[model samples]
Target: MEEKFLKVTQEGHFFDKHKSVLIAVSGGKDSMNLLHLLYKYQDILDIRIGVAHVNHQQRRESAEEEVYIKEWSERRSIPFHVSYFEGTFSEEAARTMRYDFFAEVMKQHDYTALVTAHHADDQAETIFMRLIRGSRLAHLSGMRVVQPFASGELIRPLLPFPKSELMNVPHFEDESNYSSLYFRNRIRNDYLPLLVNENPQFTSALLHVGKESELLHQALRDLICHIDVTNLQDFQAQTVAVRYFLLQHYLEEFPELQLTRDQFDQVLNILEKRANYQHHLKGDYYLIKDYQRFAITKIQPKTDRQEEEYVIESEGVFQHGSFIFSLNEPLEQPDQIIYLQVHQPILLRGRKAGDRILLHSIHKKIRRYFIDQKIPQKLRDTAIVIEQEGKIYGIANMVASDLSKSAKNDIIKATLYIKMKE
Candidate 1:
């Protein structure tokens, strides 16, 4: 059994051979078997092993499962961490809390990577789920062996092994897994059997397809990275062209991956308009256009913000009003006279009723001059104004001046970045 598991790990390139691994254990058959296999090969593989369990508090027996795992780890002298989440245990909520706890544990222990017991059957079920939900090529690619998690990496070592093999291993079954109401169990029991009856090699074929799709997906990602347009002016326009070119290229090579005529046109329109657009493709893949770039994100139901932001100092990268202010050195240019200086106690506040700037070039009141320039009245209050010593020196999104004539050659520079509010 150990030799067979070792072969499976080799096939999947599970742990990079020598990295420390944390296995998410639920005292379920798959997780228990995974822990056993890892422990069996720990010395040979030069791997440090740890177990993490999340007591979701969903089922009454969940507490028993946690106790079993805790005792099991203690008897074996393996490090173990457990987290309990109270209240609701919706699948999404449970997953989110579980990963959050796992990440914290991983960070505390400085673990290099996390291993999961997601096997070939899991991959097949994922693919089917995405396909039924209208996923794209990227979505159909299924679970990746190595993927980025919070602070570390998630490695699926058992992907190349079948669930049949996992069942054959000495393990305990979770009664919860028998419910067909859960999408995954439904696919496993009802759908997978039909596919297997039709073609005994269906699971293997899906796994093979998943591997190939993963390679293709990686190549596409590499191409996008290689064509980095970070500094290109009108980057959004360029991104639109890049996306269109990619779609065309894929269509010519693999027509099966092509979006429908209307869908393709919609993508083109989204690129051309440079707007946020969500495209539901044939498979469970979604093309999301956010500002300048396009991404193929998974099609999960909309989730609330999982991360929260706290108030920060006004000097550094801080969120103010509805904008992210990243204070940096102002661009020095001979023609541009509106730049703030360092150590200058400039107040960042909203507009005042009697705000006025000395237009050095014109020698006139800035308010009157702006009125003459036909500046809109609606923008008066919301505009940011920088004031010092009860006088407006810099108008937000407008202009600034050198207060002291003696400091003409001082070359003081400060920048204000106004971000759009969502």
Candidate 2:
């Protein structure tokens, strides 16, 4: 299936030598075959390969499975990392821990990409799962071959491969998959077989549907990503359909905000009416309309106690009430973070008058900057601003000064997050 693997890689833009990949292995047939194939072609593909395995320790054989994968990695001289969970795990908990481990492995090992062995059957199962959940096509299309990740791009090179193709590989069997105890297991083992028996090509049919879903996503992405935002007046005057796609594209870059259906429609309404409105979405998000523009911001709750500013003297994360001021992860994108050369006493305080930034070679007053960014007027006065020696280093979502623009290698960065009141 080397040709099949090549077809998927070329089709998905999955791998490259510049970015190292951390393959998630479970010693199961699918992941085993994936690791084997990647290892076989590592030199030819000009990519470095490593392994990340998580032992949730939920089962009796979990440790044995970890040892098996560890020995497999060592025998091939491949880099490997394993994380053992310490707490009880629900299915979602296990999944969360697994991805969390994947991210940590990537960061600690300097690997820039994550590879998962979710094959065609898994894709079909996901589609079936989402269909029953009454999911929208955006959520129901199952998994994409490529997705932007904080660590790097997550790629599924086996989206086109089937379990039957990988079964020949030597692997461990976790019989939990066949057990009807889990909901997915019931779908896979009980319901799907009935459909597959009726139509042998059912999985292939679902694969085609997934491919089309991706095409639609790509088309919308192309239309939205390069949209003429420079002509603000003309752009803002566009139809609601245009603004919907704009928000879709915006959400891809900022994953923290979970925009719900009501919130999204409200966003479009705000764009159409050009008025003041505030609607709370999940994740502490308040979709606010600022005249002609729309913004997603967080509200600091009011209590009998007064809000206090924080003195951040070192590279660390600290929280004061609903506000969290964190020394952010190392600079990822240039525009995403600010740099500091020294560890000075930085005060995390509310926005102040005359607080201006020289952003992108233009001097903008903080009030004007907030207006330009469409920050809600209420949030503008109380927005978090990081300052040192009377120089505004960073605002909530901006690297304020041109001088403080972080270089690619800069590690000192900071961010502010406001937790929504319960």
Name the top TM-score candidate. Answer: 2
Cα lDDT computed for each candidate against the true fold: 0.66, 0.71
Local accuracy of candidate 2 as per-residue lDDT tens digits, 1-422 = 97778766765567753458889999888899899889988876779999999887777998889998899899988988988877776788888888888888878888888989998899999988877776656665789777876568788888777877774788888988887889899989888899999999887887777778778887887766555331235457667677666666655544677666776676666556645566666777666554333445565565344346778777655665445455643332323345554656777677643345657765456667777778775666556676676666677554457656643236643443333233
Q: Judge candidate 1 against the unseen true structure and give its global Cα lDDT, from 0 to 1.
A: 0.66
TM for every model, in the order presented, reads: 0.58, 0.67
**Candidate 2, pairs of clashing residues:** none
Cα-based RMSD of the predictions, in order? 14.1, 12.5
Q: Which stretches of candidate 2 lie above 4 Å from their native place?
A: 6-13, 17-19, 225-236, 239-246, 299-422
Model 2 residue 365 distance off true place after TM-score fit, in angstroms = 14
Compose the digit string of candidate 1's lDDT tens values, residues 27-69. 8777887898898898777789999998877778888888888
What is candidate 1's CA lDDT for residue 98? 86
What's the CA error at residue 226 for candidate 1, in Å? Answer: 3.8
Query: Clashing residue pairs, candidate 1?
Result: 134-283, 134-284, 135-283, 135-284, 135-285, 136-285
